[model samples]
Target: MPKSKITETLLNSTVSKYRNLLKFCYFLMVFVVISCGNDTKSKVSADTNENATTETETEAPATTSSKTILFYGDSITAGYGLDDTNDAFPGIIQFKIDSLDLNYEVVNSGLSGETSAGGKSRIDWILNQDIDIFVLELGANDGLRGLPITETKANLQAIIDAVKAKSPSTKIVLAGMQLPPNMGQAYTTQFKAVFSDLASENKIAFIPFILKDVGGVKELNQSDGIHPTVEGHRIVANTVWEVLGPVLNSEL
Candidate 1:
């Protein structure tokens, strides 16, 4: 072959070899870059976990039980239509507190069909004496009977403010109740919010929705589908005691 032809062929072979070498180097660089990215991501995750651990460690300590609580309100609170000892949440709560050997008395002040207006009327008579804590479980009947949320809220506010005024040291807990779904969404939403709003304003503990687990279940409620059965009451007791047992300091 001629010298020029031979040189051209040699140049073509060298260019092909150089292209292959360039591709191999590029792939190695890409692999190293991916490895570095994974390491950086792992470090960030570790740092986030470390910060979370430190935040939890710096959180405040929990407070122990402080005082006795009196259960006050309407029919459900009063144990309406339930047998003397059977299916009564108040009775069940009393048993548990005694069993736990806690220094809190479960005082039953439930009045059947009692409205917020009625509670206001008898607040002076029913509780002329002092109390360490008050569990307000009203507004169920108000919502059930389709009473105005405004009136219910006002009555509840009055009762809480009265207790605060008379017994400034008392810790109050507001037990929430949900109005029936049939009562339109607007009304139900407002009614449900009343307890939380007041509790927030007063800096009190709230049960959110007391009848949550008790309501709707066929076995839990009685024939009326309104009152909870004895077993249901036990569950209710557990619910209230969950909140009540922690704050009580001594027997009432």
Candidate 2:
């Protein structure tokens, strides 16, 4: 073969090989661009879905329809001296309610050393929430403090009237209290009569004594001899349950 013919043939073959390489590079670039675009779209879709789920969860409302039982009182109801406040009568009552699967929540609004007057002052604030049952145990501090029977009675009545004014349908349970003999028979007797009289006048549920079985019992009371011990709270819970159980059942 001639040298010119061989050179022409080599040139044509080289040109054809270069054209095939260019086509392969073009196809590879197209595939890379398509793949990158799909990956970006997939990431955006995932981010949008994630944001929608977060917004849905954040905007969801918490729906709970549990009735509240408010125990408004002093140290006895506050469970003073107990390591865990849940060991208190009101907390124990909550446990009982939970065990029975009742839709009632007990709020222990018992403050240490809260008297009738103090309770009267704050009762309005406490009543701000919807109360299914309101347990009144305020007078013990009044009696312990040797407050005037008339003033104590008046303060208690005011509290009762406030409760009635707040919600007429709210069940009020007045827990009766007794003073020690040291407070004098005349004063103690009058003080004792105050609760019963209020209960009768108001036509509300009466607890003859909040600490029926637990009060004055050396073993049941704590070292202070004022607040009840864990065992004492158990008995007190039973006492409260006797009246509260029926009231709650009536609601049901």
Best of the candidates, lDDT: 2
Worst 10 residues of 2 by lDDT: 140-149
For residue 102, what is the lDDT in candidate 2? 98
Cα error, residue 27 of model 2, in Å, equals: 15
User: What lDDT score belongs to each candidate, Candidate 1 first?
Assistant: 0.83, 0.92
Q: After superposition, how far is residue 230 of candidate 1 from its true place, in Å?
A: 0.6
Q: Write out the backbone clash pairs for model 2.
A: none
Task: Provide the TM-score for each candidate, comma-separated.
Answer: 0.70, 0.77
Put down candidate 2 lDDT per residue, 1-252, tens digits, no spaces.
Answer: 999999999999999999999999999999999999999999999999999999999999999899999999999999999999999999999999999999999999999989899998998799889998999998888888788889999999999999899999999999988877988989889999999999999999999888897778899998888789999999999998998899999999
Judge candidate 1 at residue 178 and give its lDDT: 88
Per-residue lDDT of candidate 1, residues 37-93 (tens digit): 999999999999999999888885776663456889787877776767434787787
